[model samples]
Target: MIGVLIVLCSLHTGFAVTHTGKGCVTGSTGVRDLPEFVAVLMLDEETGAYFDSKTRELQIRLEWALNKVNDSQKYIHYFNVLISSAIPDLMNALQFAMSLYGHSGGIHTLQIMLGCEVSEDRKAGEFMKFGYDAEDFISLDISTLAWIAHSPQAGIICADWNNHIETAQFWKGILENECFALLKKLVEYDREILERKVPPEVSLLRRDPSSPVTCLATGFFPEGIVVSWQKDGEDLHEDVELLETLSNEDGTFQTRSRLTVSPADVKEHNYTCVVDHSSLEKNIIKPVTEEEIKTNQDPENSLPVGIIIAVVLAVLLVAIAAFAC
Candidate 1:
């Protein structure tokens, strides 16, 4: 019996190592390219980002399963591979990727790597909000895939939506639990900001005390909201700021927020922005400023509230659109 081990090469790519699956040790393709008979599970999410030890475990699980299917144990053979990070449309994403693998008619295996849990109303902007602000700490990507069950010649491993460490003991429990909590915070915070009648200034930026991240956050609330940065929850940027509180095309009331920090604050304080709004249940996240990010190298970006939701919704529609809708 040939043994096949499919390892996750990166966020959007996987490699198939076969020893017992067939007379193989044969298919060793480059990372960016692949042979015709192998199916690659590309994990695009973890590729550019740093996944701590816990999330890395999830990737490993997917790797183990990939090996099983390709081994001589009698899963499908002679299929190509499709690698991607976030599935734009679960079904469409799956189907489209599979077409490359030659299993488009009805794929035997469909896997998902879930990093965040979303409410029914998940959107692109909201989906990306956490990823945007999650400097090296925020959780916005998948931790692992689960193979719930299978048949004689086939099986399935996917993203477990109802992941629970219940008491602990969940698969890769540490990664799933913490990452889930962080993503939820983003949704809750956004909803609060949206509801505020007199929403205070809000800025979301990333400044690493270890090393600053130089990426400007995009503010697209459609509410004419201004955003900036702070340190120790204190406001930043006067000489080093871009204060732009403009009139909306419709001319409503949008509050101003700025993001700024000093070298001392960056080195010593845990500064964050605090926007006091009448509509929000509480203050939203303390955002970073341009200066804070300018000196930093691994600058974290914030995803405004509109885009992530759109991407997630699109992906949901593709996978089980009928069920999703």
Candidate 2:
């Protein structure tokens, strides 16, 4: 049997410390752009280490993560052992799942995701779920320690997992105790970097005279922020589109709020972009004037080519929408 493997890591929003691990296996080889097997470890949003089947060696990516542990070799060995054993199990499970669904002659992927989080108020959460072909298959309800099958194909696996009470307990123990402890320790080790705030560089942008005015704030840290529009010193809610905050490669964040109004209205009315962030002493107020608005059409006010490139790069770097609501 031929197969492939993939791993992904992500962080949760509003949590003081978050750790997530994911593994994926495919039933056939020759899958474009996928490795045979891979494993990655992350602390918050930063990758600490990674291992791939091709290299067959664990590589520490973060200096702090390496320094935090006394026995780096032992830590690496532990993950190597876990991943070495899991590869075959994941492949077999994927094959089994595919067979159960009567799937054949094409690549099929099975993914396992597990994570834990600790909030500022001492609240905690844990999750473990499986997906097939990018759709939910089964999940573990940590509250009840039961397996919930999302599809008919997952029923057998669910029943089998639910019967193994010890397995659930094992995960519960790690998530509640070991995982929490590790995350806290890591957070403490990197507290300065994680907690430090950076103010945003705000700008006003528009594509043309007829386009909606965009108020963009970039290079901010700690994520929590608000971008709003105002007209004549009062809040303007109508014809406004506030976009979700996006992550940047430098661990900062960027967001924008757009106001749709006619050129005539814009020229006649006083409009401004209000930005509120934890790092700022006071809110940033940027007036949307013709002279201040960057545009591609207007030669004198054309947006800087470098800034446009940065915006495109930021959009591409968005692996997932870190915040939802």
TM-score of each: 0.20, 0.69
Candidate 2: residue 2 lDDT (0-100): 21
State how far residue 229 of model 1 sits from its true place (Å): 5.1
CA lDDT of every candidate: 0.29, 0.62
Error of 1 at 93 (Å): 59
Number of clashing residue pairs in every model?
55, 1
Stretches off by above 4 angstroms in model 1 are 1-230, 233-242, 246-264, 287-325
Error of 1 at 41 (Å): 52
What tens digits encode model 1's per-residue C-alpha lDDT throughout 18-113?
000100001121223322122222212111111111121112222222343335222221111111222223334334334434553521323322
**Which tens-of-lDDT digit does each residue in 1-325 have in candidate 2?**
2211222224345543433322222323346656555545455555455555667676665565567677778867766665555556556666677787998747666655555566552536777666677678887788889989999878977788788877677667766775566566666667786778899999888888889888888888777899988899999999999886766656677878889999988788899899999999999999988888888531232111101001111111111111000
